[model samples]
Target: MKNTLKISLKAGEKIYVNGAVIRVDRKISLEFLNDVQFLLQQHVLQPEDARTPLRQLYFIVQVMLMGQAGEGMEKTRQLFRDTLANLLSTFRNERIRAELKHIDTLVGQGKVYEALKAIRALYPIEEQIFNKDSLQEEQVFAKAVGE
Candidate 1:
């Protein structure tokens, strides 16, 4: 029998594997964690590309999930922690948070279609802001108050 593991990505990407359906909505934020898991698996199976930021974060999340780490693993875990901290510290986007929360609720209530619609609405904005450093911080409060 093939062992199936359901993993979710909270960054708005849901994928089903084997007989398991993994919901990637924001309430759980599983995508970021899964990304870390992928990185760790890559490191153990293929160490050559472990230097990348994404891979590094994966390694750290893996170590933390494993409970204990040894020599080399400890260093890698620390690096991952530092990188994640830095990323989270500078990553302040209220709209994304609100959207993610809404998605999570929709997914939990089995409203997949509505969740998809919500995600679609934010896709363009997400892509634009994802890597850009100079984009104006959107005024989420204004929109919230208006609503």
Candidate 2:
């Protein structure tokens, strides 16, 4: 048998498990005796917070994991595939691209939490790329104006 997973949640904290939203009335600990998909409240990304490409992709995968009643699951999966393909083509950094492939493998294996963690780890690298691109755009604008 697989080992159990234990989770503790504070009062008012929410957890998404197998497409169900659960809010604790008080501090409580939960033990999952079997395999399950879950996302803690702190890790749940709000729609407004999905401002970048990776964040957007994360949101889609998050939906696939948290969506209730399996509604629109196939569509969400398709979106995940489409978004992942775009991200693979869009990123030039070898590290990000390589990690993305790993994330794809994790997702395919139904390891959503691990895939989310992998995606979260890439945010800093993505931010650096974003800053660099912004700086380049600013420099190009300055040159055009001066010319």
Candidate 3:
């Protein structure tokens, strides 16, 4: 509110600001002298990437931000919490659990950008978890065949 923020965008790059999508024709820099809600291009997640539990959570949060909290926002929020709850049960690592909790709090406060950042930070950890689960499943199958 009191401080200003500056953003630079490259040609063909897009930014979603307060529910509006803006694309730069060329390299441009914008300065916001007041509070604003915006997301950069790299941070945006494609719908197809929502296959994972945490990614699904991120998609729901993105919809809430872009939809301007219109009708169904609450339902979307419910989905977010539900997704988080499911992930919490599946991921027992304290670090992952703590990140999920922090994301929930950020989203509750309408800080979608921060929530997305938090989720992105956990992506590598999630990948590791998924790989481990796959390896375990393969081992189980191998044991069954050997028996």
Per-prediction TM-score: 0.30, 0.93, 0.90
Mind giving the per-residue lDDT tens digits that candidate 1 earns over 60-94?
A: 44444344446765675456446655644544677
Query: Which lDDT values do the candidates have, in the order given?
Result: 0.46, 0.93, 0.87
- Evaluation by lDDT, superior candidate among 1 and 2: 2
- Worst lDDT 10-window in candidate 1: 33-42
Global local distance difference test of model 2: 0.93
Ranked by TM-score, the better of candidates 1 and 2 is 2
- Assess the local accuracy of residue 119 in candidate 1 as a C-alpha lDDT between 0 and 100: 48
Kindly provide the TM-score of model 1 when superposed on the true structure, using C-alpha atoms: 0.30
Model 3, span 11-120: residue lDDT tens: 99999998899999999999999777888888888998788887888888888777656558888888888888898998888999999999889988978888888888
Question: Which candidate ranks first by lDDT, i.e. highest?
Answer: 2
